[model samples]
Target: MNRPRLAVGATLACAGLLAVGCSSPSQQAAPAEQAATVNVALSDAGCSPTPATVPSGPVTFAVTNSGSAAVTEAELQAAGKILGEKENITQGLNGTFALRLEPGTYSVYCPGGQKDTWTFTVTGTGPAAPTAAPDTNVADATTKYHDYVVSEVNLLQPATKTFTDAVRAGDMAKAEAAFGAAREHYESIEPVAESFGDLDPDIDARADDVDDPAKWTGFHRIEKALWQDRSLAGMAPIADKLDADIATLKANVATATYQPAQLANGASDLLTEVSTSKVTGEEDRYSHTDLWDFAANIAGARTAFELLMPALQAKDADLAQQTEARFVDVTQQLARFKQGDGYVDYSTVGDADRRTLANSVNALAEPLSQVAGKVV
Candidate 1:
């Protein structure tokens, strides 16, 4: 029987998101006193009121769960801007979209292609803020990094499939060969494992050998299992369990329970890392680990912005205010990464190849945090 490789990257993306997304702002109103409220529903049918609009500057969205099945999450968008989204919708029968928004065009969207179809607008003198420029250089580098990681992650999928096919076909040797191919991919990325540490600790935590390898224990163990020369003695039973677990995980991926508020409450690990990524002096060169943290923080801030857009549109002062405050907090946390000297060295430093890890860390976090705080 073939042993399955783990979809560790999926968890990596999620783990990073959870680390950062769990820190949404406390409930607060927008600066404008009377924020409007819009109540909506999500279902296999569609979002009602094909086209919708609301006055801007602090709006509140009260979403009611009238559908037969439960709605796990909600989002608001307009002009490529994510206005608001709530992942904490456990009210089996009753739920509310409590959020604040700013003046702008908006739409209430849902995950898994459950778009609201209707378009909405929030009109008013919204909060004044400056524009944010995507750090193209940083983005390009990060994109390359993400692609490399994704490729390695994707490579395991085929190997896993091969293992499954072999097991189902009763071909242990073929399963072992597929496992070998997968292991090659893992070895290719081992030198850079430190870079993936924050994004994928599960795979990183595994031992370096085949026999006595950690069994397919979710992301890390399964991933490590894929790379080993199939321990036929050990791999057979593990393959049986993996085949079952994959089905369960895929089934739950879509309608899975999401707790944004709960997630928001547990962001200290990533947030603390963001806050502490400060640069110290001329030694400002950064490692892949710093960049990984940088990407996670940026993604988190972006998620928060999208989560709050709807509330801003509804003129939900408290919701908008709270989101803004969270943004502020996240940004402030990021700011600690910036240098007190107002300059960054994108290149390496010193004849001895010493790096000013502190300063570069601060530099990466500061601008991103500023962008997150200001990008409405």
Candidate 2:
């Protein structure tokens, strides 16, 4: 479900610029701390790296895209788990993402490129020495953020029920409307759900995210049935599966725990989601409700950042202020497309407007990426 950059090129319909409840990995390294940095290039052809092995602990992938229109993002993955990623890299832009990696080979994936994937190796040296014990601010941030994740799942079940009910009843209008609404809840807390492993994919994976067509079951599968196929027949079973999956998600998150950096990374990941998949309109391709998702992802990012505000501000007041300003910049741009509760249809969005939104997201993402480093 993580390698979505390649198949996503469509622009989003609306730009809600809403708040955050958002994904995870654990590591603690301040920006001033030294770590192994790997430079990865994403181009029209594919992903490339300097190819140096480093002892594993803390590693940052410095990503740069040159002369590539299709390649919008890059991800670092091993064992089907997304370790880290940097997204929304329009041509001529550079981005970076960090993680505490164990020694192993990882894939550098950039879709819609000539090559699309590359191998990078990390030597096992274990994680860096632990940082000082976290202060109360960190504890509060994690505790509140975990509750936020649980809240989203709570909303997701009932909202999903509304959509599933509509589908079962064959009411296309209500189903479509409910579909986007339910997704907003899901997208906002995607990072938390993602932490639960297969549940994320089972509940939200797109057609492209899976290898077997039979394995494709989630909001997207139901989406295709309603929009592309234009019928609700045989949807009841799929709806049932969705109910089960989301129920399972709720149960899993009830006991979930989080680290400080994981919250920061989850916030950043949601923005990456918007920049890469939601912006492309590829996520809700059949319905063209990309804006709804765009807004929800932002909502999640904001929620996480705000939850960590105390710790972040205490550590680096300037960084906190800068991140807040960036969020405002993105939200201001998105405000132009507002249409009552939602925004205009994605198809109606002009090319210039698309560029404006993309630029704003890129700007917001820039400062947001540094958050984990600051707080941790």
Candidate 3:
């Protein structure tokens, strides 16, 4: 998040006024102690606190997970010191952490920079304890869904891996057959996607409309857009539209904002990689058929999110909003990673690249699921 610039006042009149006040002593009042509770969650960018407010003195933070993501822990930190933390927190929906705290400013943080953070200020005296919301029953919900997605991914993995391996081996026939089978498997889950939207849109989109057939194009929409015979001639136009959509989507999704120069720097580098890097295909990768470019893109995004996480933990919404812009950029490019470096055809890429892409996509499922789960 952006840090506020401190200004020094050195006017003679101002100095004289300060001196007068200092010279005149008055009764001092002791700072009052208060109590409060803060709710926190993990995100792709940083930790997030619901309500963003805490009472003074001996405050208890109750961190809760209301979605289908695995969050191992939530921690409270300040001044580079770890104040308190709850580990082995529940995953999926309804997991929580309760922390007792003294009145002060605290940062709520989660590992992996995958959650938003908040800085809560506790002032004078605790209020009467408020009743807690009943658990959302997220643990049970997460178990059921996690098992389902795992099963689906397992069923599709073999065929997809085969297609990717065939591509790497330059076996066109095998690649074609494997690609078709993988597509069918992914399509089969469309009806179940709606249930996973809270975890990952790609999966949710799949499960929501498998019956549509027209909608069950699998990953080909992006693949064809980037690698089809005519796609290159129109790369600029398509990339332009894609970039525009990314900006719009980021704007739609922004929920916080904070100090941005550093964030902007990271975002600039990320965008450059997308627009000029080999994986985005501005550079030739045929001579170097490795999928490192795709991997780098994912790493860059994860880095940007990490850089912005601290600010998010401070509850700097403005910072979160700005960082999210970059987040969207990275994720959008990631979604298209399959197309870069000739991996779109599924048969043209190696098994390793395919697996890497799948893992990257899967990591996003939980956070996206949580975002979608929020009514807002």
| Reference-based TM-score of each model | 0.30, 0.75, 0.24
lDDT tens readout by residue for model 2, 320-373: 999998888887777887788787788788778888888889888878889876
Local distance difference test values of all predictions, in order? 0.37, 0.74, 0.36
Please estimate how well model 1 matches the true structure, expressed as its whole-model Cα lDDT: 0.37
lDDT of 2 at 190: 85
Question: Candidate 1 or 2, higher lDDT?
Answer: 2
Clashes of each: 52, 12, 43
Point out where model 1 deviates above 4 Å: 1-32, 49-51, 79-81, 88-91, 96-100, 112-116, 125-376
lDDT by residue (tens digit), candidate 1, 176-226: 444434333433333123122122233323333123444323233433333
Output the lDDT of residue 305, model 2.
Answer: 92
If the candidates were sorted by their lDDT against the true structure, best first, what order would they fall in? 2, 1, 3
The digit string of per-residue lDDT tens for model 3 on 152-214 reads 455655655565455545554554444445544333332122111121123212222244534
Q: Which candidate is the best by TM-score?
A: 2
TM-score leaderboard ranking:
2, 1, 3
